[model samples]
Target: MNDQLLSARDLKVSFDLPGGRQAQAVAGVNLDIAPGEIVALAGESGCGKSTLARTMLALEDATDGSITFGGKSLPKSTKKLRAFRKQVQLVLQDPTGALNPRHTVYDAVAEGLRIHGIEGSNEYDQVISALSQAGLRPPEQYLNRYPYELSGGQRQRVVIAGALALDPQLIIADEPVASLDASVRGEILALFQRLRDDFGLGALVVTHDLGLAWNIADRIAVMYLGRIVEQGPVEQVLLDPQHPYTRALVSVLPDSPVGDPQVLTGEAPDASQIPSGCRFHPRCPLVASGKAAEAGIEEKCRTQDLAVLDADPRNWQSACHYSAQFGRDEVRGTAEPVADSLG
Candidate 1:
């Protein structure tokens, strides 16, 4: 057996607004984090990445489908949920806000252990070990310091230590470095990679920055307006994107340097006003008949929603009317390959 640590199937989270309407924050998203893999969920803000993270951790109720951990379905009971909490931990975007202002760093890191009934010399040793593992050197110096007393990087490290203190099998990091200064972000990214390597931890990292995803993710899942548009090995998806939304996202990536010099255009539809037919057709460059015909793309993009198509079961997959036509810019040896691939 493959022993996947976390799997979310058709996960959807919707909220009822003031009127008799619903806002679908997450819509039918499916993902699996195999043991020790770092799966990044990348997209623009409000694209449902964070919503999906909360749903996976059962922090929010799912409107549809399920989340399974270690082959077992998540239980609905509070007691069972508490047990689930011990196995999954979250590191939020702002470390300063995440920690209690009044508590010492040691108290913050040791809080999880205390709640789980872990105590005494062994737990204290583990607390120090976790802080050290997160690269908070001179662990003793940090133990009594409050959040305001630490630097941004050090405060973030303390939060990471708190998450690690629980001995969690999976960590859900929601833009964990987005709030940090540029100088400090790289170190935090390295810490996450180190944690994954040393502890064999699975991580679900939600971020809008494709460059960061490219740097740290083993595999990438691209989201658009609450649904997964494409997913595959980081290199495969970043180098060769099949979905139009994925292509647009990659076009804007600072490191990609591919696509037309002209800025890609189009706004994501509001969740309440999603369009008919393919939700992306209005913004998809490939949907125009002229482009579609030249690329050998069919009419499916205009009238049908494409199912997730797996070109190679091992890595590549996409939900696009003409995914087969798309090729990596690297493969074509042109930063802006003739829109030929869109067919």
Candidate 2:
């Protein structure tokens, strides 16, 4: 049994602007999330993290590629789509805005149940059960409260409770903790981790915070200009960082004490005018520099496209030609070839 709760293969999403030009928001992304696993999609503001998340949720249409849920391709029939939706849920970035001000907590959580034709005492029990699962104990007390009455964390919990009411198999969260206060962020993240523990639910969180990925995710996928540059186990991607862009993002982390830091320059290239060859080569130090200290591989980087490969099932891989030299910048007073020192 492939046990993959959700998967995307070579997915691309594009938007056509008024000028008849198209912008590819997500470009050739391949990802999968298994039950009880957390995959963090980390990137800058316009790196298409949210776009990819939406495409995975089937909220946004993909211009190219396919999405599969529970080992089957997307359902085209209305009955099948509705059944699929029941198994997959989306948790938006803002909880306060997601909830209705006029509706009580019970009403908000029961909306999904009612939509599926669940009503009467059965609906009430499901609502209370979901609230309790979300850590809102004494669920009856919160049943009548409005969105305004609850704190930010509590409001977010309510949003999660709504999703839980329907017993979804997967939850795709776009910047799930971005809107909450510092104190509340940890609590909400813990809730997500607990969800996996309790029901073996799969979760995919999109965020720009590397630390958050380190704190909660089992795997980390680094994105740049809509393409995934590197992805691997949390320890491998965060500590070893096989790609240059991944290194730049990890270098600035508060606990990263070793390694040389290369500050990124300029803004991410526009999607419509994405540079030729390796999309990240223009700003990558190694791409322009020689293979050795005095030798550069500018020609190779400018004309060739690097494809991601499976290095080992345990360690994640990158789509860079220079994957062999990732940590060499911080050589620690060492020579390129250890045998060279003997000469």
lDDT of candidate 2 over 109-193, digit per residue (tens): 9999988776777898999999999999999999999999999999999999999999998889889989999999999899999
- Local accuracy by lDDT, each model: 0.80, 0.81
Total backbone clashes of model 2? 4
Off by over 4 Å in 1: 255-257, 293-299, 308-313, 324-343
By TM-score, how accurate is candidate 1? 0.90
RMSD of each: 3.9, 5.2
What TM-score should be assigned to candidate 2?
0.91
lDDT of 1 by residue, 16-81 (tens): 877787888887777888878899999988888898999889999999988899989999998888
- How much is 282 displaced in model 1, in angstroms? 1.5
**Candidate 1: minimum summed lDDT over ten consecutive residues — where?**
334-343
